[model samples]
Target: MASSSTIQVKITAARKKTSLLRSLPLPLTLSFPPSPPPTVRDVKTAIQKAHPSFYTVRQKLSLPDTSKALPDDSAVLFDSAGDAELSVGDLGPQVQWRTVFLVEYAGPLLIHPLVYHLPKLFYGAEIEHSSLQKSVYAMVLLHFIKRELETLFVHRFSHSTMPLFNLFKNSAHYHLLSGVLLAYDVYRPAFSAPAVAGTWRANGTLLTAAWVVWVFAQLSNLSAHLTLRALRPAGTTTRAVPTGYGFSPPFALSTPNYFFELLAWAAVCALSGSPAAGLFFGVSAVQITLWAQKKHAAYKREFGDKYPRGRKVLVPGVF
Candidate 1:
């Protein structure tokens, strides 16, 4: 004669095992026929079929499952298959796939070299324009660049590209390594935060503006990096090499990252607490950005109508 508690425990264990078996869905090894070029109906069916399992698992795992079956929307089915047949790029979605690919990959990678080199290159270099804010920016920018590279490339870089590499070799890798060194100087007080004595009528306002601009620049840079990583083919190398830039189109016109860099410089100027420095770097950064933007525009024009239309040369909407 088992105790009441023992009987209850036995029942509970059996119930739990039953629940696990049902949840496991018997690994449908029946090798169903290969799914055909997915129709809109096919996609809907697939989504529906996966939905119940997804929802059940979600509930078990204490997660929310918000996805629903695809609506009977009016369009050709199968928008963008990764490598499947009759996929949805040219004849499927409203957006062009090649352009999408460029934006997703090339745009982000364009700024990699800049971010890669900033910490190593500009950290302590006296500002070319003699602006204290610009100098601080150069340093802070270096710091941010270093942190970003650590996040994005820590596990991604080849062993040869990680630590000390030949800095004087004049190769792209050399430039990249050099930039990292120069940018690193900004982390020190001698490079980053020595209080430069000066007053601008708009120093406070400008500082605020500069902070905002720098924030946008950082966001834009981060966004580009992510988009590129997402777009890279399945088997490509993940190092911060320049190959990612090659396939990119000027989605926002030309040198869109250049635009953000210019904005960052302007913001640094405003925050410089000195109008003279702010004014100087503001002018320089704007001119340089404009030139770069123009060059990118020319390249896009040469590439023809495939380039995205009506987008600003750099800033997303308002140039």
Candidate 2:
């Protein structure tokens, strides 16, 4: 039955529709309001409601006619007729996106402390930590705590969920490498002594300078976060060109909070003088830089002329 506001969407398994056309599985028919036009996520949510076990993350919704996957935020448009055909490709498993961020950031916060405080667990014996080691403990804990708090309170995610595999993969990056490996390498007894950590360990001038830079970097990062947050109002997924405070014109590297994070890590490298610190900084720089580039490109494509030009992905004046 057709209604004035309700549009019926005929959805089918993408693979089954093409490969098993002869079988002709009955498409799952659903009704959605044309007004405020339902989003791809809304359609997927409805399908999930009907089929409790259906993993929305695994499903790829596409048009039956053209068979192109729809963006999560894209509106499902209807023509003069109130009927539309959509396809779903179920992948496998799903997890909340927020859970992923929390797990990733929480990794360093928990593991770093454990490895630092319980030296016997990893080091195989009682070990006295150096002043630099204590400072590193403070820095690592503080950095990740801020990230956790921000993820909980500051950032508004556009997407509600992600594939479950991201949970394990992302956790490994933070928990295994950044958390356990870095903590062990930095706080281990080998790097604790001045002789091994190098003369830089005793350099008060450099220590003071590094600490100062780290503090400023953290503050600027927070500022950048606030500035970016102002772009999208709470409870809405609407995006706009980032403006105010940390953001600059052209937005290439305008208001680069990630760069500030790297700067703080660089200060950690200066303080700890550990190979692990160097490795962490190097890896973080590369990964974050790539992410920045991708984000910039996405913004450009989304906003077009509205998005300011000339901003590099991460590095100012350099891609």
Candidate 3:
């Protein structure tokens, strides 16, 4: 019923609408060199070509002001047409990419004690003259050496890489603490005096009991680590609820390992018979307890009803 000219106009209008819809750009725009917009993979490839240092797995492409990372590298850039225009080097002004590497945790544990011990040997601390000092040094060295061996063979790290700065921080903490313990035990006149030192010597009942407890606690802690490692087989990522062992209450403590660690340090404090050792153990206890509580809450949230209901955070029955 319409005129021929009107019909032609309607047809042209429909064609123009279709063309407009077809020509609409994607939600995201990447400023890169290409005739048309490329796929995310193509963009990554282009970036890699430009900078060979950026690896695909390690590098994550993110928006300028948002924490949202691109989920799919295969996604076409046209799909993100309506988003803000992205430009090359727009990640941030101070964006410096860093390569990540894994260093075994054992290395620092073994190395930190030398910071104090080597100096003591050279500077004449008279550590070897006192049996208590010798015993304390032996215990401390044995503790960390065992830890290093366990880290190398028994433990599995949840994360493959940590920031390089963390290495220095961790090393500093251990090095300083080791220095404090060794210095006080070896150099202090109070510990070397026969009246005070004889009570905590290797042959003394108190020191012997403390040493026994330390040995037991260390062995138990190692057992806990091995048990945790066994929960997940090699080449798999799975978390399982830990069962208790030895003095640990069955299914009643969420972090029996932390408990054993605290006990071990407490024994070390008793063995050293120094206020500094006690202070270090107290501080360590608080830190480890806080960490255990956090881990407990995380486990409860993650596993929900499946998580054991009666589990304490760090202590077996008290905490």
- Can you give the TM-score per candidate against the true fold? 0.34, 0.84, 0.66
- In candidate 3, clashing pairs total 10
lDDT per residue for candidate 3 within 1-319, as digits (tens), equals 3222100000011122232223222232245434333445555454445445543433344444444556433453332333333222222112111111112334334543553456455455543345566566677778777766776677676544444455666555555555445454444545554635435344578767887898888988888888888888875557787775732455367777788888887876766666666766777787798898898998899889988787788876677
Report the number of the highest-lDDT candidate: 2
Indicate the worst ten consecutive residues by lDDT in candidate 1: 5-14
- Candidate 3 Cα deviation (angstroms), residue 311: 0.7
Please, what are the lDDT tens digits per residue for candidate 2 over residues 51-117?
A: 6566577678888755677988898866678666777776557788879999999989888878888
| Superposed model 2: Cα runs more than 4 Å off | 1-8, 16-24, 28-42, 55-58, 65-68, 72-83, 193-198, 249-255
What is the C-alpha lDDT profile of model 1 across 241-277, one tens digit per residue?
Answer: 1222312444353455566555665554445433433
- True-vs-predicted CA distance for residue 243, candidate 3, Å: 1.9
Regions of candidate 1 where Cα sits further than 4 Å from its true position: 1-198, 234-251, 273-303, 315-319
- The global Cα lDDT (0 to 1) of model 3 is 0.56
- Candidate 2 lDDT at 217 equals 87
